[model samples]
Every structure is written in C-alpha cells, then in structure tokens.
Target chain A: SAVISQKPSRDICQRGTSLTIQCQVDSQVTMMFWYRQQPGQSLTLIATANQGSEATYESGFVIDKFPISRPNLTFSTLTVSNMSPEDSSIYLCSVARDGTYEQYFGPGTRLTVT
Target chain B: QQPVQSPQAVILREGEDAVINCSSSKALYSVHWYRQKHGEAPVFLMILLKGGEQKGHDKISASFNEKKQQSSLYLTASQLSYSGTYFCGTETPGGSNYKLTFGKGTLLTVNP
Candidate 1:
C-alpha cells in the first residue's frame, strides 16, 4: 500500500484561473493516477502519469486543459488550466505499487471554480 | 465502457443488511470495491480477480461472476459507520491497461 498526500485540500478559484495540485507518495510507484469526481458523479480517470514518459490521458480529457507533470517516481502535479464552473469537482491522486492490485488514495483536493 | 451499478441508493437501519450489484457489458479482468464517505476519498475494500470468487472482510464481502461480468457486494449486519457511497470499478480484460472504469456508485445510508 502507498501513502499519498495532496496539496491544497480545498480551494475556491475564479473562472479563467488555473490551479496546480501536488501529489506526493511515500514510496516509489510505477504509475500515479489523477481522477476527477464531479458533484454526485462517479470518478473519471483524467490521466495516468508515469515517470520519464508523457502522461496517458483518457478520451474527452486533453493535455491542454489538464496538464500533468511527473518529475520523479514519487511526485506528480496536475494543473487545471483555464478553469470554468464546469471544472468544479474533487481531484484525487491515487498510487498503486507495482505488482499490487490495491490502490491507495490521498485526501482529495476539492476545487470550486466560481 | 463504465460498469452499471443497481439500486442507486439504499437506506438501512443499523444491524440490517444490504447488497450492491455491479454489471458490465465488457469482459473484466478484475473488480474493485471502494467506499467513500462525504468529504473523503474512496477507500479500497477488496478486489475479485477470477470468476465465481468470493472475498470477505469483517462481514463485508463480495463475489464476482466472470461469466456474467457482474459483481455483488454484501454488507451484513450493517453498522452506522457503513453509511457512505459505494463504487465498483471494472478493469477490462488486461492487466496491462491498469485503467479502471468506475460505476456511478450506490449511496447507502445507515440510520441509527
């Protein structure tokens, strides 16, 4: 199991602004995942961040709107750029150690874009 | 495709039981169960990796039927702490994908 922590537990931002959320893991992981949960909705995978390689994004989510950076095995950052009211949601960082099926998640950052 | 969970919401009194079901149209390699309380991240409960497999932890158990591409979560003698939203995530038939498409979730409210 991995222990993860995300910065800015909750933030209220205005539209057109950008917010960068940082995720830190206690141990090295092969991959880190960014997920978004809209109000009263299920989690949607935003991207898969792998160290030294470009992040893999899911359909409907683009790098221009949500830029991801993985500088090392234990750290990653996701930036929600040009935010809008529709971007208001909870962002969670999750990590699963290689060879393990269980994923551990950090306390999510709740962003309300007004 | 995202899995579908039935009984969008359930209300139960403490000590009662509840079951949550998740089904998918695509073949699955694994099914993961998670419970999330308000204002918190979802916590992993268990994962079923094979057909007709059942796993349990302290009265909270789950079964996966690979043939049907469906899974069920059983919470027996539910406690107050069990009040939360439950989600089932399914991974398509590949370990390499590592991407899980989650269900809409089932909201379970346990009244005292």
Candidate 2:
C-alpha cells in the first residue's frame, strides 16, 4: 500500500478562476489517476497521469479544461480551469503501485466554485 | 466502460449481513473493492484477479467469477462504522494500461 496526500484539502474559489490540485505519493507508482466526484454522484475519472508523458483523459473530459502534469513517478497535479458552479466537486488523486491491483487514494481536494 | 453495481443503496442494521455486487459487460482482468465514508476518500478493501482467486480481510470477503464477468463483496456482522459508499473498479482485458473504470457506487448504511 502507498501513502498519498493532496494539497489544499478544501478550497473555495471564485468562478472563472483556476485551481491546481497536487498529489504526492510516498512511494513510486506505476500509474496515477485523477477523479472528480460531484455532489451525490459517483466518481468520474478525469485522466491518467503517467510520468514523462502526456496524461490520457477520459471521454467528456478534455485537456483544455483539465490540464494534468506528471513530472515524476511520485508527483502529479490536476488543474481545473475556467471553473464554474458545475465544477464544484471533490477531486481525488490515486496511485497504483507496482505489483498491486489496488489503487490508493489521497484524502481529496474539495473545490467549491461560486 | 464503467461496471454496474447494485443495489444503488442499502440499509442494514448493526450485526446484519449484506452483499454488494459488481458486474461488467466485458471480460475483466481484475476487480477491486473500495469503501468511502462520508466526506472521506475511498479506502481499498480487496482485489480479485481473473483466476477466481478469493481474498479476505477481517469480516469482509470478496469473490470474482470470471465466467460471469462479475464480483461480489460480502460484509458479515456489519457495524455502524461500515456506513459508507462502496465502489467497484475493474481492469479490462489486454492490459494496454492498468487504469480502472469505476462503477457508479453502492451506498451502504449500517445503522446501530
């Protein structure tokens, strides 16, 4: 199991602004992913952040709106740009360690866009 | 594609038993179970690979039926601390990338 942490556990941001959420893992991971959970909704995978490569985003999500960066194996960040009330949700970062089928998640960053 | 999990929500009394099911339309390489308390991140419970191997921790156990392309999580003697949303994530065949597509989730409420 890997220990994961995120910056800005909770934040209140103004509409039209962007907020970057950071994820760090205690151990090196083979893959990292970002997910969004709107109020009363299930989690939606935003993208897969691979080290030294561009992140692969899922359908209904695009890089222009949610840019992701993975500078190294243990660190990654997801930025929610041009925020709106619709973007108000909890963003979680997950780490999949090698040899394990499970993905460990950070506490999550709760963004309330007003 | 996201797997299908049911029932959407369940209410159980303390010391009761409950079962959560997760199924996929496509063949699965693996299935993972996670539980998330209100206002907290999802915590990993267990994972079952295609071999139909079962793994258990504490009173929680899970089984993967490769033929059915489904998995089930059994919670015995449920406790009040077990109230939370349960999610099942699956890794598809071919293993191009190991990322998992998670299901909508099953809301489990264990009342004392």
Per TM-score, the best of the predicted structures is: 1
lDDT per residue as tens, model 1, A28-99: 998789999986789999999988889999999999999999999999999999999999999999987688
- Model 2 C-alpha lDDT per residue in residues A30-91, reported as the tens digit of each score: 68999998856787888888887788888899999999999988999899999998999999
Error at A3, model 1, angstroms: 1.7
Q: Candidate 2, residue A14: CA error in Å?
A: 1.9
Report the Cα lDDT for candidate 1. Answer: 0.93
Task: List residue ranges in candidate 1 displaced over 4 A.
Answer: B94-96
RMSD of 2: 1.3
TM-score of 1: 0.96
DockQ in order: 0.90, 0.82
lDDT of each: 0.93, 0.90
Instruction: Kindly list the per-residue Cα lDDT of model 1 for residues B4-71, writing each as its tens digit.
Output: 99889999999999999999999989999999998888999999999999999998999999999999
| Candidate 1 chain B: worst-modelled 10 consecutive residues by lDDT | B93-102
What tier of docking accuracy does candidate 1 attain?
high
